[model samples]
Target chain A: MSQVEELKSELTEKLGSDIQIKTEFGDDVLEISKDKVFEATEHFKSTGRYDFLMDVCSVDRQEREKRFDVVYHFYSSKDNRRLRMKAQLGENEKIKSITPIWKGANWFEREAYDMMGIQFEGHPYLKRLLTHHEFVGHPLRKDYDSNRQQHCSKAADLHFEDDETYVPDPNKDLIPLNIGPSHPATHGTLRIMAQLDGETIHRSNVELGFLHRCFEKMAETHEYNQIIPYTDRLNYCSAPMNNVGFCKTVERMLGVEIPPKAQAIRIILCELSRVIDHIVCIGANAVDLGALTSFFYLFNMRERVYSLFEKLCGARLTVSMTRVGGMANNPPEGWFDDVLETVATLRKGVDEIDRMLTNNKIWIERTKGVGGISSEEAIAFGFTGPCLRATGVNLDLRKANPYYGYDQLDFDVPYGTSGDVYDRYLVRIEEMKQSLKIVEQVAKNVPGGDFSIRDKDIVLPEKKDVYGNIEGLMNHFMLVIKGLQPPVGDIYDATEAANGELGFYLVSDGSKRPYRLKVRPPCFAIYQSFTQLINGGLLSDVISILGSLNVIAGELDR
Target chain B: MSTVPTVTRDLHAESEDLLTTAAYTTRFDKLVAWGRKNSLWPLPYGTACCGIELMSVMGPKYDLARFGAEVVRFSPRQSDLLVVAGTITEKMAPVLVHIYEQMLEPKYVLSMGACASSGGFYRAYHVLQGIDKVIPVDVYVPGCPPTPEAVLDGVMLLQKMIESNQPRPWKDNWKGPTQ
Candidate 1:
């Protein structure tokens, strides 16, 4: 039997037979009731089978009897199987919070409650996670007006029930410091409320919705093809990854396999994006640490990669270069030579940075023991990608569940000893070197063929064909005028983004636009543990920790 | 002399009227505008995708230091040119306003990227429709995260406005009959 079938059989034997497990799009989804959510999740944890809670997102079905369907993505580290648990909830009914089992579920549960108004009972600190406190109704619900924006004047006070005032006493030297919504160290809009007692952080709260631009709500209204550009903004550092990740989710729904050349392009661009993303992280982290020369070296290399992207697409930062069926266009002429040369130059830049910061005393002193997290705590917090690997976990989506033929690529996954800021920086450097190798390998052997798939219902006709002949014009009109529609179903797909696992859970109602699209941004889960990571660290360590995390506010809030 | 507008007369008399034998004669307001335009200290209010592009302008390739505006100030009090560099949502609007208000007078605002100019394509809830709803935008650079070149264009345009001493409704300046 398949592992999914084995899981179903095991679940049936352990629990009652009333639970229904069915194969949907090749993965087993266990349909459980509200009363059994906690018990089933506890079983998954206690048995040490599915030890990680990948994501928790809720879908709003306004026309159906069950107003919301809370979906849980559970993964077993030992067996490499993903089990989906779905529980239906009515309009006002509450689902049991899974935070007790998985501490990572705290922010996810709060996000569901804030966006779709789905209540998670017994969830501590269950206030608004994305939208501001002044938001009136749930914006993700179908009935909520998309244009009805609320103006938030005052800042929110996240006060506990039994909390005393923040006023510092004369005896103690404790004080509260607000870090950012506009501070330079935040890189963007992450705000941290840190209570410090003589340079060490005592307690803190993080507010990170300042860059939320309503990406999910916008996707619900746009067609599948139009939504690709919006995905580019999610992880702006790695635009092609978000594009390919979203398009792959839709491609899975359509059941179409892109050409080999297209897969090669996707892999090349994804790895290239990973290299640049890490460059930004390392460069910016060094800048925050007061070592300024490496930033110019790394950013100069980043600009070289940006030039390649400019050649492929027209834009630099937000390159929405992938379509649902395949890529928007092929790489420019002599692209392989350009890519090989760029990767070779990037290696030299990497070496220069290594010499600058690897053994430098100041760099080591600042980042060695700061923000250290154990492997168990990292897994419990749903850390993935480089951050998780920094804690000694070898869980990369590319190795575990390969997509877009990432399995065929020849590269090594870098692991670190302790999950500290230094480990993260080292991991990023090693990963960039691996990514350079992968880019070099793929650029030499790109399969040449059509860039789009064979599905007529999906890919738009070429521009020459559309303007040339009558048959092509009619075909183009049919596809572009009316958008591409998929069958009625929901699918969850993930890609190993530069930051971590970027998952897209898309539900289609057989319409041009998606019924719901939930982007499980890697930054969201990794950034949720900020307070834990920097609880006892010094004030200067906060900047280094935040930089090593590389939390993009767009993806975190969206 | 104030109403004179003949072509040759305007050029000949204008230069002669400003220069004396021993000293240079000019208005103090125009002097301050000249000083402000050439030496614009900028505070980057970067928040989203355009932020990377903003950093690109700060990078070595498209160096903003080529102009006299390379001194990036973190505190609002020290800066004169405010470059609003990304999307301004409703939650961030008040913060944007607070920063703009904190800057002293004679400060100019340059709205970079489409989101800062006209909300871009994010015309949904939680997004403030154009940052002009909260702060006075002097120049609008138009791009979905505009290129560094475009951002520089906006900054140069703000310099021109500052040089010409454009009408400041918020400031008490007298130039016309109504004044």
Candidate 2:
């Protein structure tokens, strides 16, 4: 038997007949009773496989007897296998907190509580996460009104309950400092409340929801194609990746395969996006450390990438460039030439930045050995992407899972020994070069043909054909009126985004719009460990650490 | 005796001209307004994607420094213009208002991007429909995260408003939007 099958049978025997086992979208799913959740999860963790808790979220089925399905996704770096466990609960029913087993589940559980109103019984500080403390209703619930507005009388009334008295240690003379929610260095809309002993931080807590645009809530009302624009706003730095990941999920449910040319174009766009994402991460990190020159150098290259995206999709930052079963459009004439020119310019800029920052004594002193986490702690906290790789874990989804023919491309996954701020910087810098290489290769080997699937239901006919041919006109009218309908099932699709694994867990009820859509943002997992990473570090190091993580508020609060 | 009489006449005439020029004062006002318009130090209240575009405006290509408004002061007290960029959620609305109130007199507010101008595409619960709901805005630049050039244009519009001596809502008895 295969590793997944062997594990599946073993889990079925161990968890009793109450568990229901099924395979959908090539993933093993275990539907367990609510009471046995903690026991089964603990058993799964103790087996030394499934070491990483990839994601934890809840899907609301308002009409069902059990109104919520709390889903848990786990990955085994040892055997490169993925397992999903879901426990169903009725309204007002409580589930045991998984934070005790995986510390990273803390935020996920709080988010579930905040969005769905499902309570986690033993979760410490199970309060509002992505909404204001005064927000009345759980937003992701199907019955929740999309247009309801909740207003606060004053900013003073917006304090967490624990903010009144909680302290890391009552004995120590620690000064409380409020870092942001508006400060420039905190990036978007993140607030850090830190307790400090002298200049060193004792403990810190992050406050999110400042930029919460309610993307998930918005996704419910939008059709599959209409939701593509909303996905662009998530992880806006690498927008094409979000577009592709969401499209791939829906396409998988529909079981439509995109043409080869479309896939190749997608590879180019995604890699270009990865390069842009790393530019922002590294450039912003360097700028936080008082190295402004590198930011200018890298941003010039980013501007070039934006121009390329503009040529492709007519917009720069929020490029909603992908469609289900294919891309929005074919590449314009001489697109390959533009890609090569941009990559060449980017290489020159990267070389210049390398000469200036790499091995610089001051940069090393500020970054090396600071805010470090061990591999064991990183895995437990569910760190992925470059941050986990910096701790010497070779768990890249692009290589292991090989989605979208990434296995056909040639690249290297750079890793580091010490998971410090410096190591993350190095990993991102190397990753940028590798992405550039991928873009170059894809640009050369890009196939020629249709940029979308041939199916009439899935792809819109050409405007000329629609205008002339009666059959084409009929097909166009039907598509415009009734959208593409996927099969009634659930699937989870993940892409190797610049930050890490960007997964989209989609549930369809044989409708044009999705029944439920959940995004497992890489930054959401990384930000949960922020307090641990910054604890005991100097106040200034917090900026460096946050920059290294590259936590975009759009994704974090979505 | 003849030279002395001529000097006395010239002194009396020159004193009369000086007094009239000082009393009129339109030229002095215009000069002061011109200086204020050119040397506008903006405090960028950059909160989201529009903030990135604002940064690009300051970069070498667009070169906001060429317009003489490149001195971006983080502190409200030091700035004469407030460039509110990106969406303002309810949680952040009070902070924006507080920053606006802290600015020195003769300050201008440039609402850059659709979000800051009118909450763009994010017309949902958490988002404050428009930043104008909290503080008065002098110029509204319309774009979903407007391009750097658009932001620069907004800055220019603010400079023109300052020169024209447009009546600021804050300067009047205008209370902000009611909840």
Candidate 3:
């Protein structure tokens, strides 16, 4: 029997007849009650082998009888499939926190509580994740005004009491250091409060939301097409990846198929974006270790790729390259030539970085055996992409559940045994090489067809047709004035983003705009384990680990 | 004057010979401004995408070192030019303000990118409308994330502003630390 069928039967056996299982928009959903959700999730991790907890988010259906739907996405590497478990509750109702079952659910659950104000019963620290304490309302709720702004005049006074279980010895002397919301090595706006015992980190508390620009709340009001530019800022380093992920989800929901050429082109751009993302991560990590030359070398190559992107599109960093049905524009003539040239040059950069940092004693000493996590711990913390692979767990979404014809593309998934800072760096370097391979393969064999879907409902008409043809003009007006009117439904789709699995949960209300849109940003999962990963390590190793993880503040706080 | 003490007094006494010219008549403020304009120690207040563009400008391609504003200090205490590059959410607003306040006198705030200048398209609950709402801005480079060339232009404009002896109206903040 299939995993879904087996899950249904098994869940029925565990929770009695109180559970409901059905497939919606390509996802096998198991609807369980609040009282039994803890049990169901326990079964998911243990018996069902749904080892990876991809995302946990709450949906505020302002008009629905249940009012709120707490969603949990689980992926089992053993089964190589995803299952969505949801529990519907009232406005004031509290659901079971899965933190005890899956430790990675800590931040995801806190995010649910913060955004939608859905209380989790047993969550250890039920504080806000992506907003300050002074923020008045749950910003993701339908009633929350988009224009409402809350100013935090001072720093939040929050203390994470030792969970009522472990009281610290009052006599132990330790020093506290606040690293960033803006400091050099912290990269972006992530803040970690670390208590040090002579340079060794004793305890740490991560504070995010300093860069949260309300991406989810903004998407609810924006049209299907308008949300494209917003997604660009999600993972600004790999802007096209976010665009593709969002567009692919909407296209899948719209039930439209992009042309072969668009699919192939999407793959090329996304792979190129992945390459750039890895380059930035590795370069930044190397800089933390005082290897500055590799950063310069890698970034020079990054500029070449950015210039190529500028030639394809008009922008550099925030390239909103993809659209709902297909791409915004076709790859210009001789673009593949540019791609090939850049790819050829980028490989040398890869080699240069390899030569510089791969076997260097200082680099090895600084990174190896530092911030290492076992494969089991990594999985329990819901790690994905290269970070998960570095733990010796083979789970690349591109390989396991291929999208945009990733299955046809030939490339190997590189993995490391010790899941340390060094392994992450190595995995990222190898992934960049593999990405270059994919880029070369796809750029060589350019597919020929319409660059976008032929559907008039989603794709805009040609400029010539808009100018000359009456029907085309009207069609253009309708599309531009009133955006895509998708059928009323909700779907959860995830793509393997550079950091991990970037998932988007969308609910359409038969309007041009989405009723609700929740982004399951990848780093949001990996970065939550900061305290767990860096607790016993020295202060210096923290920067190394953070850089390797690349907890992009854009996605982390968004 | 008190900070410099006898250094400026002795320089004034020996102005003719010390400056390597005997007949030169230049105002002290102008000379100070000229010196400040060339070697602008910029503290990059980078928080988002525009920060990446800021890095690009500082990198080898469109090197910021060409204009002599390349000493990118992370500490506010050490910098004169505060290049606020990226979006400043309300949560990040206090931090931005704190960083701005932490900067010494004659510090210039160059609001970089559309988001930093005016919140770009992210006009939502959490985002601060523009950083100018919190800190005084000397230059505003506009783009979702401005191109490297545009960022370079903004820096050059600030240098020009410095050279022309524009009043540092934000200088009023130097009277006493707000905190």
Candidate 4:
């Protein structure tokens, strides 16, 4: 038997007849009783099979007898396989929290609780994750109104006590400092509440939801294709990746295959986006360290990438450039030339930055040996993408599960041994070089063919054809009036986003609009470990650590 | 003695003529307005994507320094103009209001993007519909995340407003335009 099948049979035998095996949207899904979930998860983890908790989310099906499905996604690095486990719950039923097995489930559970009103029984601090403290209703519930406003009278009332277990010592002279929600060092809308005892931080608590634009709530109301624009705002730094990720997820549900040219174009756009995201991450992180000169050198290259994106699509920052079966449009004339030129400029600029800051005494002193995490801790916390790789985990989804012909592309995954802030910096810099290499290869071998799928139902006909031919007109009318409808099933599609694994947990009910859409933001996972990382460090190191994580507020609070 | 008096009188008349020309050369209001317009220390309240565009405006290419607004201050007390760059969520609205109130008198606000101006496309519950609901905005730049050039244009428009409007003392009964 194949590894997945063996594992499935083993899990079924271990969990008994209560577990049922099924496949939906080309993913292996196991349905388990709610009570057996914790035991099964422990067995799976302790057996040295599945070590990574890729994502944990809950979907609400209001009309069903079992109203909620608490979905858990697991990946096994040893077998190079992924598994989905679901536990059903009725209206007020609570499931055990998996935080003990995987600490990364802390925030994801909180998010599920916050959005869908699903209660995780053993979650230590089960509070609202991405909504205002006084938010009235669960926004992601099927019956909740999207237009309902929940307002609080005063901002002071919005501050909730953080993890009430830790009481401050009255003997120690701890001074409270509020860092952000608007401060330049905190980047985007993140507020850090730190209690310091003479420049050394005694304890720090992170406050999020300041940039929550209700994206998931908005996604439910939008059509399958209409939701592309909303994905762009999820991780605005690498928007095309989110766009392509969403499109790929819906396409996976539809079981449609895109053409070769579209795949090549998708690779170019996603890699370019990776370069841009890294530039912003590294540049902004440097600025936080008082190395402002590197920011200019890097931002110039970022602008070039943005211009290339502009050339490819109309928008620069929010490039909703991908559609369901393919891209919005083919690359314009000489687009490859523009991409190559940008790649060359990016290489020169990155090298210049490398020389300027890589071995700089100040840079090393500030970043080295700070915010270091071991591989085991990283895995337990569910770190992915560059941050996980920086711990020498080698857990890149692009390599482990190749999609869109990523296996054919020539590139290297750079990792760090120490997992320090400096190592993350090195990893990102190296990754930028690798991304540029991918861009060069993809640009060289871009195939010449249809940019979108030939299926009339999936893609709208050309404007000229629609204007002239009756069949073309009919197809256009059908597509425009009623959007693409995928099969009735749920699928979890994840891509190696610049920050980490950005997964879309989509549930479609054979309708134009999705029944439920959940975004498993990588930054959300990374930010959960922030308090532990910065607990004993100096107050200034907080900025360095936060920057190194590259936590974009758009994704974190989405 | 009579001829000496006439020569002294002519000298006094010439001095008086120089004094009158100097008075006409620079009006007090115009001088104050020019100083305020030329040296606008903008407190960049950049919160989101528009914040990046605002940074681009300050970069070497756009060169905000050319307009004498190079000194982008973080402290509201030091700043004369408030450039609200990105979205203001419900949680952030009070902080924004406090910052606006902390700015020194003769202040101007340039709402830098769609979010800042009118909450743009994010008309959801969390996002504040428009910053104008909380604080007064002088100029509103219209773009989802307006280009750097558009932001520069907004800055120039604020300068024009400063130059045209008379800078009456705060003690005077002249109130600025209310939201």
Candidate 5:
């Protein structure tokens, strides 16, 4: 039986007549009544079809009749399918939590509680996950005004609760180690309170919002073309991929067919970015392993990649280059030649890095068996990318879904048998080589054309042409200021990011700005499984696992 | 211009007589020069992807070792140059300010990216817009990363700025501009 269908059938058998099952794009969706959600979740898990509670997040349905709908995304590792169980829980109502079934759902559920104001009943510890403990209101709700500066009552009092005078556990003597609002290793402004049992971590909780740029809200406020710049901040490592992800999501929502040349260019750029992301991961892992020399070696390779990025786009990091249809600017003269040269240079460096660490005794000893996780545990905790591949799960969305002519490209899906840190490292290295292969294929197969979809409705006419023609001028004006509007629809499109399945769920309400924009960031899924991976491991192993995961705070908290 | 006991020799003889000028004034000038030269351990505070490029600045090709800045300390106490190498968000502002405050006197900062210098195009409510608001910037190395060459230039510029100082006057004249 196919994974999707099997999950649906199993869900139907479990829920019986109480739930309404719907399949959206091969995902088995179960719309359980608000009252029966907890019961249904329990039954679904008992059925063994959806053993893992992948993620529990709530979406604000302010415009719709259903005020607030909570989405509980489930995955069956055995079947390799996903099942989403959503409930139309009324505004300000308490719903039963599924934290009992899966311990991993603790953080996800708490995040929903903290952000969406959805109270998860029966949660062991329902404290705010991302936002401060004294934060005034739910920030993620559509109606919530993010502009309000006085969200927290006081700097000391960062979170709030229904209890008038709430006091945390006094007996749990956990020394406060303020990781960062600016400290290194936390990456960005992420501060985690690690309740440690000496060197071992009893429990750790993340305190995000230090770098919360309100990107989604801004994207909603800005025009379509204006929002592309914002995507650059989400996955700062691979700005091109984020741009492509956003554009592709909007394109899917609008049902616009981009030119073959544009598609080909995007694939090439995205794959290059994937390679860069892996290089960073590998370099960072090497740094954590005390192999500081390898960092410089890999950076030498990255310098060449940056040159290509500069040649292709004006900016290096904030590459707001890829537009909705074509590109913001044309490639510089001999850009392809420069790209080919860069690849050649970087390829040699990659080989050297591989030689330095591939069989090195110290590197293997540090990473070989450290932070080993099984495929089942990984899937249960919703791990993806090289992290998932390390566990021998052949699930790269690029191959499975084949967006942007990915199916046409001849590349290998590199998987490692051992789900250890070493395997993850090996997978990322191999993935980089495969990315090179894809880049080479794309360079060879790149079609020549206008580089954009020649359409007045979708893509703005040239500035000169627009000035010459009245209609073109009007269209350009509209596109520049108000942005292009797509019909009302919702679509979820995922690409194989270096980290994992980087999915962007975009909803257009026949307006220039997206009505709803939810980034299914790969880092969040991988980072959630962090505590699980690091539970019994040594203190130093935390650094190892974090590096291996490549959990960028920018993408995670976004 | 009358023979006034030749003030230089008179002062020297008088000082020499008075316990040999009470020893040395810690050789203030040389001490300052030595302190400045030996301990330039920088806090390479990087955020976003530009941080990766910032890391490249300390790497082999453009080794920061020549300037005695190879030891990129993560802590503020031991660091001299705080290289803000990405967008500074409002959420990160206070922390940046705190880190700047924690560093000992005679410190420098390098806003090492378009985002860190001028907010790039990520001008949003959460982003501080620029690092200038949070800390006094010594050099603004402009690029998405300000290439290793640009970083070296900024470092050299900062060193020159530090070197051209006339001690007391430099200390007194240092108004510490907001930028």
Candidate 6:
């Protein structure tokens, strides 16, 4: 039987005849009772339906009797099914941690504890992961003060009380290595404290928030269109994906359909972003592996992409051009022709790089079997994007759940079986080629229409209209001052980002800004599985696995 | 009769030197100019997205080698110019200062982008605000991400700045538009 059906049958049997159990909004979710949650998860894992514990984040429902709801997203690699298990937990109640089933859940559970104040009773190590050793009050709770800076700083005061249960490391042989807040290979500002037994990682604890800007809080204050600029900073390498993801989520919430031309433009920009993102990863990875020459060759191509970006948007990295309903500006005339030229140049450049590294003895040796993880393990650990693709999962959200007209396009979902650093590299390289193909198709199929949605409530009026007409001026002023107010509801929309499934879950309470904005960053999921990839491997292998995963700190910490 | 070609070559070289001397200055000055022009390995203090574009400058496309500024040594110890690309944060100030201090004498700084030039829109509490506060700048390439062509132009400007120092007639001419 299929995983979803089997899950449904099991859930129905548990809930009984009166209680309703149904999948909502076509997402891979199965609603279950708060009491039977632990039992269901254990059954789900043993059934071999879902092995990976993708994310376990919570949302606050102030009005409900149970003020907090923990959302657990699980994935079954064998069936290619995603099961979201949500259980409403009262503020006083605690859930049993699933760390026993999946080792990767250790950090995720701690993060939930740190962010949402949700305690996991049986968690192995439930200490603060992102915040300091002595933090209090979850920052993500609904009633948590938005203006209170004390919550962030005061959280450091809560001490990790050591009693009889917490015995110090009995064997003091392992050396402690702090990877960085300043180290070169940590990517951004992530400091990984690892206990090592002579070049082999005994246990790795990832410390985040050194670079955290409180993006969710910032998004709450900013208007919908204004939020686009901030998204660029989140995953700066793949800026367009952030733009498209934010726009798509807002579009879904507003129930507005964009012009075909705008969709095509979004596709082209997203593909360009994907290509450049891979270029950055490949170049940085090559440099980390001691091949500095390839770094220059690859980054040179990324510069050309940057030029194209400049021509399209006034700003390059922070190209905050998307409106709630559609694009802020249409592509200039002859834009497609220029994109074609750049694509040709990039294709040749990519080939040159492939020639340099495809058979290079050092590269192959360093990356081939290094940081290898099986498909089952990857899925169990909630690996996504090229990292998941490396494990032979033909599950690109662009293909499996086709958003932004991806269903209409014909392209291959390239995958790998080995799930090693080398396989991840191959998957990204092939994915870039596929993205190029998609861009070509988009350029060919772009149609002519209004770029922005005509709905005045969601989008600002045209510049000409605002300048000439009083009514238009007032509308523009309102939009600039107070953002669009969507209906009071929650919407979660995702896109296949260059990294993985970059999902945005926005909760609206009839306000100009989001009541609660949660970004399901794929990097965070991939980062949770880092210790797994590096445990038995060499110290140098950490660089390879970290690069292969392409863990951008902005996305991970945010 | 045996050294006729050598004598002519000497005469040709002497006459060319005389012409160059009449038009300009001493041979010692000319040698200094030559030394400065041939070796300008720019140490790029690239921080943000513009750093990507700066990489392109060294890439095969623009090939900064055509103008003798190709060797981009990351170490400030071995380099001449600090190409400060992207936004420099306040926290990065000490490190950038240390790098600038490490660079050899007669170094130049190229603040590449709006953020580095002035503080782009990220003019918040933490940004270094402007690179000029930390180090003396030679040329500022103004753009959110200045195009590779603009970067090349900045390199040429640096060369001109160096060339004008050699006691030349053009140095007395109008100093070009303030970039």
Q: What is the lDDT of residue B152 in candidate 6?
A: 91
Give a tens-digit lDDT track for model 3, residues A490-512.
88888999988999998888999
Estimate the TM-score of every prediction. 0.94, 0.94, 0.94, 0.93, 0.85, 0.78
Weakest 10 consecutive residues of candidate 2 chain A by summed lDDT: A153-162
Q: What is the C-alpha lDDT profile of model 1 across A418-437, one tens digit per residue?
A: 99999999999999999999
Quote the lDDT for A66 in model 6: 88
DockQ, candidate 2, vs. native dimer: 0.43
DockQ per model, Cα: 0.43, 0.43, 0.58, 0.36, 0.28, 0.09
Over 4 Å off in model 6, which ranges? Answer: A1-9, A15-33, A48-52, A62-66, A74-84, A132-137, A141-176, A194-205, B1-179
Residue by residue across A157-187, what tens digits does model 4's lDDT show? 3232464444445576477677877687888
Residue range A29-148, candidate 2, lDDT tens digits: 888888888878898788877888988899998889999999999878777777888999999899999899889899999999999998998887898887776789898888887667
Candidate 2, which segments miss by more than 4 Å at Cα? A2-5, A156-173, B1-26, B169-173
Give the number of the best model, judged by lDDT: 1
Candidate 3 residue runs with Cα over 4 Å from true position: A1-3, A161-172, B1-25, B170-179
Candidate 1 docking: what grade? acceptable
Q: After superposition, how far is residue A238 of candidate 6 from its true place, in Å?
A: 1.2
| TM-score between candidate 3 chain A and the true chain A | 0.97
- Please provide, for model 3 over B25-71, each residue's C-alpha lDDT reduced to its tens digit, 9 standing for 90 to 100: 46677778778888999988889998888888988899899999988
Error of 5 at A553 (Å): 1.2
Q: After superposition, how far is residue A19 of candidate 5 from its true place, in Å?
A: 4.9
Candidate 1: give the clashing pairs: none
* Model 5 vs truth, CA RMSD: 6.4
User: How much is the lDDT of residue A81 in candidate 5?
Assistant: 65
